[model samples]
Target: MAASKIPGWVTAELFEDLLKANVEGFSKVKSFKADSGSAAGENYATIMLRVNIEVELQGKSRGRSSRIKSDFPPLDGKSKPVSYMVKLPHQLEMFQEMMKRTNIFDIERTMYNQVVPEIEAIYEEVGVDITFGARSYDLKNAKTDYVALEDLGVKGFKNANRLEGFDQAHTERVLQKLAQWHAASAVRVTTKGSYTDILLDGLYKEENRPMMTEMMKGIGSNFVKSCPTYEGYEVFIDKVKALQPVLIDKMFDFAKVDPMEFNVLNHGDSWSNNIMFQYDAFGKIKEVYLVDYQLPKYGTVAQDLLYFLISSTKLEDKLSKFDYYIKVYHENLVEHLKILKYSKPIPSLRDIHLALFKYGFFGYTVATGVMAAVLLDPTDTASFENFVGDTEAGLAFQMQLFNSPRFRKHIQVIMPWLLNRGALDM
Candidate 1:
């Protein structure tokens, strides 16, 4: 847990600065220990730090030193080792090029920096309590790209089981919070003006088009091949294959506009893994936090809703509670928007239904791959450094995903459903 064990991306000086910025009344930092249980997320390396400090002032009133315990009870600062996540700019030159081109790190930086303040402002205006991703350091013009966010785990927010997805109760909690954020979009435009300078979200970014095209090429090829033969679904298979060449392009187009309303900035990756929830004193779920803003896209809220349902909820839960989830989201949107003083007409339940249907492609196009990643055993997963070591290795890693039983089970239901809904069609 020594500071030397910290990742190379974040230097000791930088971590100290972040600690002082977030932690209060600590004049001299005595010792900092890294948490041993940290793991590397797909795009970032997450290490934790336990920081201790001495409240020594430079020229304060002749302070007595010995046995001077304060009555504040240590300021109650014990949270499961504040996580420090550093963006992984892959060591491989080619992959680094892709990383920069896709702006994986940059998008998150933008979200934490520019967009989150706007989000917080709207939340404050609406008088609600919410938490974004970990608190970031030098977020506006961050050099190495790191964030010191509160670990929701410390706050009792636990991850949903990726293999099983979440039930309606958990999904309901997430949806309600999502509506609040989405409704705030209406307020943001009015107050914050615009954000033309920052990098656009993934689906809107020109640079990401090529990378997504490449990734989708692999995902789509395997998806089509997963379906051996269906008596009446060959046309859907052909459609899916045809999409191989332009699936990425089509995704961008599908999300370009909402027929009923303007697009809200969505948590583009809202799978079960990206959300955390906590229970109330009564042991019922009461709070939700959406993590990982790397792919925050400006689009229909239904886009986020459907993606969450498809990838994060079990089939039966989705079938049973799909309509009810939408209703909760709609109600929250209407109520929170009223709180925000939004002038635009909130989309009704019927409009939201149609919106979800229209945005089904957003879910179907990426759900299989997302679900595959969710099901992957961490032991079998490759680190970003090793995964992008070579083109063949990268392709091999993808093939492993395509062949996994978890991925296979997911596509069995997803592929056929997308076909039935014509969500895969251009």
Candidate 2:
């Protein structure tokens, strides 16, 4: 391996120090390679090394490296290399303990340890390796906060902003997988009381209130200004204001639901961006790999299901298949729960579907506000910036989506469904 130019951000001493801190044998260094991929960030690199065997760390006695490695291939069609990502936690001024406490890292570890294994077992039973990859590391006195894991051999879904021509079958498959994911988490809560407690504590923390409130205010204001003809604009605004207190109060109420029957493990953030659509030769989603465990926490199954549909799919497309999509998700959830040996039958899909009406609007409201700022046409960046500068202009841009044909049709479809189910009050 060549000694490529190390970024100014990474020092040679830091690399050597981390290697020594995590692994034991350094008697012979056969080969070393630094990752040169564009996806490689400032502080981390994928390093491969061949070293003489020595005494292994306590937890990693199975002969693992000090860093993470992946079985997945590189995206650039290069040779598959043993890789490890290095992060200098102390030098980077990041608190490892505090990071551990955050919902992001906690959910990540949960997925890595709990969810992945279960999914792997299922895949193995079915005679396939549908798992994305895994990370291996030792936390004791590490010089950096880097993690090394098996690469998945593909770019992240974030690289694509909007997916075109997504068919109903693909949509159903994704929803079904999400159903399985939520079912697993719900079962975990039922069987593991302590795990559920930790998850709920993090999910409804008061610290999140201020940010949520700010976002709601910005979005509500945008909705009103965007559609002067919108019949419910004023009512929506009033409802939003009234709901702020409730939103804060009810953030943790879902935790009170009986975990024995109601809880399922959920991919806290199941948006399309967090899922990779592994394609076959025909370029369709042959399988999906869930990613980004940053927001994983215990909550109602509806929370994850509704959030993914509203945030990831176009409002119009979702409305078209709303009934079918909901049915598929519920059917899959029930099937997985029974297979996993849950004593109680899973709730009716209709119950979950009704619950979505109560919570579905939440994701739409937030997504519209965020997409306004982040998803504007690149050429219209200046217009967006200018619009954002004016309080009224910003509000108009934010509400534009709500007033669009795409959104109105969605509301028409969903509002009736909610009204019929008596969930309109919520």
lDDT of each: 0.63, 0.49
Per-residue lDDT of candidate 2, residues 262-364 (tens digit): 5555666665445656566776566666655545555567667666665556655765776777888888878777766666666886778666655554454
On residues 226-284, what C-alpha lDDT tens digit does candidate 1 reach at each position? 65643344656677667778777777787575535756877788887678777889978
* Model 1 weakest lDDT span, ten residues long: 71-80
Backbone collisions counted per model: 2, 20
Candidate 1 off by > 4 Å: 1-11, 24-27, 35-85, 139-143, 197-203, 229-235, 258-260, 280-283, 382-392
CA-only RMSD, every prediction: 5.0, 8.5
The positional error of residue 307 in candidate 1, measured at the CA in angstroms, is 1.9
lDDT over C-alpha atoms for residue 352 of model 1: 85
Q: Estimate each model's TM-score.
A: 0.81, 0.64
C-alpha root-mean-square deviation, candidate 2: 8.5
